[model samples]
Target chain A: MPQLSTFYHTLLRGRAGLLTGAALLLGSLLSGCDLIEFSPNETRTPEAYSDLTRKNLERLRQQPNPSGGDTVRFVFVGDSQRFYEEAEAFTQSVNQQRNVAFVAISGDISDFGLIREMRWVHDRLKKLNVPYLTVIGNHDLVANGREAYQKVYGPLNYSFEYGHTRFVLVDTNGREYGFNGRVPDVPWVQQALASPGPGISRQVVMSHVPPHDLDFDPQLVSPYVQALSTAPRVAFELNGHKHDFSIGQPYENGLTFINSYSFEKRQYVVLTLWGEKEFKLDTVQY
Target chain B: MRRALLLPLLLLASLLPAAAQSAASAATPDTLSLALAAAPAAEPEPAEPAAAVAPTGLTAQPWYRPHHLILQTAAGQGLITAGVGYTTLRGRVDIDVLAGYVPSKYSITPMGIFTAKAAYSPWTLPVAQGRWQLRPFSVGGFVSHTASSGLNNSRDGKYEKGYYWWSSRTRVGGFVGGKVSRVIGRNRYGHPRTLGAYYELGTNDLYLSSIFTNLGGLGVHEILTLGFGVKFDL
Candidate 1:
C-alpha cells in the first residue's frame, strides 16, 4: 500500500513526466495495433492497403492521358521484391518522366509474399505522381501470397483499358502452384482479350514469368501462347522474373515477349504505343 | 537513417538504469524487514523457516511438473496461444512449450502453431512490500512450426533442393519484454503465488534478412511485432 501511495505521489510531482507517460501510452497503443500480427503469412491487411489494384485503376481513370493523341505511354518495371532503396529512386525517376500515363510493374511485388512486404512496397510506390499497377509474381505467390495478393491487389487476372489500349495482366507463376496447369487461367486471358470493345485499339498482355522460362508451366505454354498469338490487335506480351530487359520473338508463331528490368537493375522501360501492334520501347536509367 | 536506428537503442539504454535505480531503492532493509514481518501474519500455511529460504528451495517438486501457465496473443505466433513453462536458475530462466491457434479467417485454413521458447530475466524487483513485482527486462528466443491443412508446401519435391532456402512452415524469432506481477497468495511450497501480465516486442528471421539486405531502405520498427499475455504461477 505504501509503495502504491509512493508511486502515485511520484506521478503527481511533475507535469512533464505525466505527459511523457501519456504520450508513450498513446504511441504504444497505436503501433501495438499494427504490430500485433497473427503471422507473417497472414493475408489480412488494413483497409487502406487493401484492394490496391482496383484503387490504382480507379485513380488512373480520373486522370486524363498525359500523352494527348491516340498514344499511351507508361513506365514498365518489375520484380520490386526487397529493393526498397531502389523503389524510392525508381519512383523519383519515374515521376520526372513526361507523358507517363501510369507505371506497370509486371510482378513480384514482394519477395516473401508477406503482407508487410506488400505494404512496404506500396508505401514506396504510392508516392508516384501516377498510380501504378502490378501482377503477381512467383515470389508473391509463395506461402499464402495468392490470397494476400488477391486481398491487397484484387484479382490475379484482370484487364483494364485506357487511351485505346487494352492491358491484360494475369498470373503466370505456374511453378508456385506445382505446375497445376490451371494457372495463367488461359480461358480467362482469352476472354479478356477476345473483346477489346469499340474504343480499344491495341491489346497488350503482361505477366510475371515469360513462357520461355522453365518456371512457367510447360504443359500450358502451348495453349497460353496460342491464346495470345491469336488475340486481335495484340501488340506483345510483357513479363518480369528475368530481372533484365530483353525483347525477342522466341516462339515460331511470331509472338514478341518483352522482359522488364527488375528494380535492382537500376533501369526501367518506357513504352509508347499507338495504332494496332505498333509500340516503341525506351529504357531509362534511374 | 542512422538516427532512426539509434533512437530505439537510446530509449532502451535510458530505461534500464532508471528501472535498476528504482529496484535498488525499493530493496532497502526497511522494506525487506517490513515485508518479512507481514508475510507470516497474512499466510499462516507457509512454514516460517521454509519461507526464509524459499527462493532457492521452491523447486522441490518433480522436474517434469510445470511451474506456470501462459496465455498469449499475436507476436506472429497465433490469434490465441496457451502454454506451460518450467522456471529454473533461481527464477531467472524459464523454458516454455506453447500451442497456438489461428482461425481460418486469417488464412486458407485454421492453423496450429507449436512453439518452444526460452527467456532470461536478469532482474526481478519486488515492490509494494512484496505485494507486487516487476521484471523490467527479459530477452528470449523461440522456434515455431505452423501446421495447416491447406497451406501450400514450399518444398514438397516441387523444385530442386534449395529453390526456396527458407521453410514456409518453420520460423525462428527473438523477443525482448517486461512483466508486472501481483502476489495473491502463498503456494504449498511457501513461495509467493503470483499472476503476471507481460508484453513482448519481437521479429522473425525473414524480417531480419529483409532489413539486413536493405538497411537504408527499411526501418527497424517496421519489422517488429508486439504481443501481450498473462502468466500464472501454478
Candidate 2:
C-alpha cells in the first residue's frame, strides 16, 4: 500500500513510483549476477556458482556405463572465452550424443580472467547432458584470475579417475608466473605421472598451454616432456589455448599431443578409448 | 538487511506529511519548504535574495573546490570506495576520484582499485514532501585500474606478440540511475548543505563487449551492475 502511495506520489511528481519499482525490481532480480561489480578483478562469486570443477567431476561419475564395458568415450572442446553463443551451440551438440560420458574444455575458460566470464561459461555449459571439465589457461591467470579460477574451479593441478583411465589436469601457464620454474610443478607432475597400482589402465594429461607453446617455461620443457614420454601407460596429452585443432608429436619422442577446437570453431572432438594405448579420435562439426 | 533497507523508505514516508503541512500554512511555498526543512536547527528563514544575505569579509569558497564529500559502493568501480568531487554544468555534472579495497581475508591477494568517474544528472524534481529533490535520471561512465593488472602483459615475455589482447587492469563502463537529496541544514560555515542517497546500474567494458558480440544470447540486465552511495554537499 505504501508502495502504491509512492506510485501516486510519483505520478504527482510527474511519473515516479512505478518507475522506481521497475528499477528496484531489476536490481533485486540481478542482485547476485555480478553486475554490481565491486571490482572487475575480484573473485567474489556466491556459493551456488563456485567450486564447479569438483562438482562436475561428481556428475561425471554418476553416468551409467554401457555394455561396451571397458571402453570410455567423451567429447572435447575448448576456449569458451566470450564465445557464449557458441558455447550454447556446443552444449546443444554435445547433448545429442548418446555414447559420450563427459566434455572436457582444455582451458581459457574466461577471456579476461574475470569471475563473471567463468560463471557465464558455466551457465551455458551446465545445460549439457554430460558434465564438462576444464584446466586453467593463460588467460585465466591474468589479474586476480588465479584466485578467481580457484574460487570457481578447483586447484590448478588435480587428477580424477573415470573407468580405466586416470585424467591429470595441470597448470602449465608458466610465463604468467614469470617463469617461476616451480610451475608445471615438476615434482607434482612426476609424482602423478608415477604408475598408480592396478585398476588405472590409461593415464591422460591435460593443460591449457601446449607443451610446444612459448608460454610454457623454457627451463622446465625438457623435464616436462621427459615426464610425459616416460609415464607408465600414458596416452596422448590434450590442450586448448591455440584455438584450433591439431595433433602431432612435437618432441619426436613418440609422445602425442592433441589440441581441441575453441567454441567459435563450430566443431569439437570425441575420444573413444578401449584397452591400453588404444583410442579413436572423431571430429564433429555442429 | 530488509529492515535496514526499509528504514530509509519509512523516513522518507514520515517526513512527507510534515513538509506538506508546513508548506500549506506558509504564504510562499519555496521559502516555506526551505525554512521547515532546515527548521529544527535554526531560526525560520525570511524571504531574501541569496546574494544580499552574504556578509562582508566572509566570502563563499571558490567554485573549483569540491562541493561535496561522497561515499559509494559497487558499480564495478570498487567494493567500498570514498572520494570528493565538484559539481558543474548547473549541478548536472559530477566528477569523482575514488579508491577501493578488498582485504586478504577474502582474496588471496588483497586488491586495490583506483577509479575516476563522471556522472551527469539532467533533471531534479522537487518531491511533494519536505526538501527532497528527486533526480529522476542520471547517466555516467567510469574508468578503473587495478593494482594487480596482469592480463595482457606476460611476466617475462612468456607470451608472443598479440597473445592476450585485453588489459586486465584498466576497465571502462557506463551506468544509469536516480538519486534523492534532502536539505538537512547548514554547515558550520552557514552554507546550505544536503544529504543524498543514490543508486546506479552499470557494466564494464568486457561485460559490454561480451553482450555486444553475442547480443541475442545476452541481456542488458546480464551486463548491468548496481551501486549505492550517499553524498553530503558542503
Best-fitting candidate, scored by lDDT: 1
Report the lDDT tens digits of candidate 2 across residue range A54-114: 8988888787754276788988888888898888888888888878888888999988878
Q: Write the per-residue lDDT of candidate 1 for residues A1-286, one digit (tens) a residue.
A: 6975576566435422232233334334654367878888887789999999999999999999988778999999999999999999999999999999999999999988888999999989999999999999998877788888889899999989998999999999999988988988999999999967888888999999999999999999999999999889889999999999999999998989999999999999999999887889899998
Candidate 2: regions farther than 4 A off: A1-33, B1-43, B46-64, B148-162, B186-192
Write one digit per residue (lDDT tens) for candidate 2, span B54-112: 33121334433345666777776666776666676756887776666666644556656
- Residue B211 miss distance in model 1 (angstroms): 0.2
Q: How big an interface RMSD has model 1?
A: 7.3
**Model 1 lDDT, residue A31, Cα:** 41
Highest DockQ scorer: 1
**Cα shift from native, residue A104, model 1 (Å):** 0.6
